[model samples]
Target: MATGGEAVARLDDGRVIFVQGALADEAVVVEITEAKKRFARGVAVAITERSAHR
Candidate 1:
């Protein structure tokens, strides 16, 4: 989760992952389309665990 309450996560290698169409506290599988030194951009491919809000 991100400080601003966005559905952001971190990879094991310390890469910041921004997930689009993801809900806060939702567990999902993402596909990284772009990778960078500080961050990575991705979209949620599957929601393994849905959030209570959903």
Candidate 2:
């Protein structure tokens, strides 16, 4: 798990992770998929914990 601030992740992974309200900067368990673009978009299937930003 990794924590970052203002992570601008490319939405290529075709997984619908956490929506709004989920914490930011905390690593979350996600199911990711490859999007049309050359990046990975993911959805947080499970939130490991609250992010520091929360």
Candidate 3:
């Protein structure tokens, strides 16, 4: 997956998930991240905002 920036999403059950990449910025991998019940939190290793939104 790819994304431009960091993003945090809260599920209906209140689980918080964070991802960093271009896909996340454009909401492309939005549903992919929610497919599993649990996963590791994404750290902004580079911490750069490729997206214009930032």
Candidate 4:
């Protein structure tokens, strides 16, 4: 998780993506909303696997 509360994750290509409304250890399918050189911003389009802690 980030300081801003967005769940931080990495893509298959290793780019960092900040996902909205995601919990720690959750498997989410993200829809990329913004792209940048070092990171990306996205929303969880679908929760592929919900977090057990949630």
**Candidate 1: regions farther than 4 A off:** 1-6
Candidate 2 vs candidate 4, TM-score winner: 4
Which 10-residue span in candidate 2 carries the lowest summed lDDT?
Answer: 1-10
- Report clash pairs, candidate 2: 12-35, 12-41, 13-33, 13-40, 13-41, 14-33, 16-43, 17-43, 17-44, 18-44
Ten contiguous residues with the weakest lDDT in model 3? 25-34
Q: Give a tens-digit lDDT track for model 1, residues 8-33.
A: 88888998898886888888999998
Ordered by lDDT, highest first, the candidates read: 4, 1, 3, 2
Error of 1 at 40 (Å): 0.3
* TM-score for each candidate, following the candidate numbering: 0.83, 0.42, 0.32, 0.89
* Model 2 score (lDDT): 0.47
Residue 12 C-alpha lDDT in model 3: 57
Expressed as tens digits, the lDDT of each residue in 1-54 for candidate 2 is: 224322333333443333332455655665654444344445556777766655
Q: Indicate the TM-score of model 1.
A: 0.83
Off by over 4 Å in 2: 1-22, 35-37, 52-54
Instruction: Return the lDDT, model 3, position 22.
Output: 37
Residue-wise C-alpha lDDT for candidate 3, range 1-54, written one tens digit per residue: 425444666545666666655334444233343345664355444534355654
lDDT of each: 0.85, 0.47, 0.49, 0.93
TM-score top scorer = 4
